[model samples]
Target: MIGETLSEDVLSQLKTILPKYGLEDTELKIIQSYRDSSQLNQQSGFSFQNEAGSKIQEEKIHLLENELRILKDKDHLAQSVAKEINVLFPSVDSFSLGDFLVQNVQDFSSSKEVTVLVKWKHQVGSVERKRLELF
Candidate 1:
């Protein structure tokens, strides 16, 4: 059952059980939201004709809009990071890029320089690590 507040005990139980089903926190949140919204819709059937129901509908719309904005911002950020990574390693193919893992980021605020530690696996099964600087 969904409650007004998601308790620590519920979260702990979810954390333990979800992994066995190959579901992560984000996926669980989406599923929970969908189920909650479905329940709300059922409970409010035809009630939208009233003022109170209209206010609740407006609030839900606002909440959904905010979530959409956050998702868009995250998408833009991911694209920007991918562009930076491509610029940092032009020779690295798309498939090889998958093998690259970011180890650390060092930023020099005064100089406007950023250093990233990247570890990559080569086609020959050897691992290579590099420190790249961007200005």
Candidate 2:
């Protein structure tokens, strides 16, 4: 489901969930708040009656879980174009632009394997260097 878009139905449904912990809002107002945007983007925001806030929180958790799963899968493999680029590249000085790669499939042993041709640009002080790694 990578890159999958949330359906409008899911969005609308998410827009309607009340904070389970806002139990102090009196059961009546809290219940009514469901399917109601009357409380969002207002002073009564979150911690109480915000709808979008809850959905966003849930979506963030979902994305993090997916990322962890992808990382685990990567660990189970030997070679991959998937690098830990997001882990902050160790640049020497002020700026570093790196880990650019073109994806391709290479046929090996009658099977196709994913290959990457990576180009990295590193800059230290006024000196800039470019390196390529193919695997």
Candidate 3:
């Protein structure tokens, strides 16, 4: 049956005899593989449903991964900006990031450009200074 050719007679005989070969007699020795195949078919149906469910969930995972990457990139940019400011004013004692804002505007190139505006605050001694940085 596997890669080997079968004669029509063998095929017909197999179809005819397979079901009747093991009748439940006084001895309970019946073909177990036949019942196993039936159970496997039922289980395959259940797994098919799960497979379809996983397809939808896979898209959800993709979207969440993209959102996570964008957040990480934004955070990295913010950290770099803060580090630069810290280097410029080493005496600055405290730094707090307040809000992140995005805007669309035209630059010197006369094309639409996306601008990321970060609102932050730093304290020197008791004086707190707030500023907005853009990139």
lDDT of 2 at 127: 32
- Assess every candidate by TM-score: 0.35, 0.27, 0.38
Lowest-lDDT window of 10 residues in candidate 2? Answer: 126-135
Candidate 3 lDDT by residue in tens digits, 34-126: 244456446444333467799899999999999899778868876886788677655554455434344446553343344443333443333
Q: What is the lDDT for 23 in model 3?
A: 40
Put the candidates in lDDT order, highest first: 1, 3, 2
lDDT of 2 at 56: 96
User: Which lDDT tens digits does candidate 1 get at residues 47-78?
Assistant: 32578888999999999999899767766765
The model with the greatest TM-score is: 3
Local distance difference test, each candidate:
0.54, 0.45, 0.53
Preferred candidate (TM-score higher): 1 or 3: 3
Pick by TM-score: 2 or 3, better one: 3
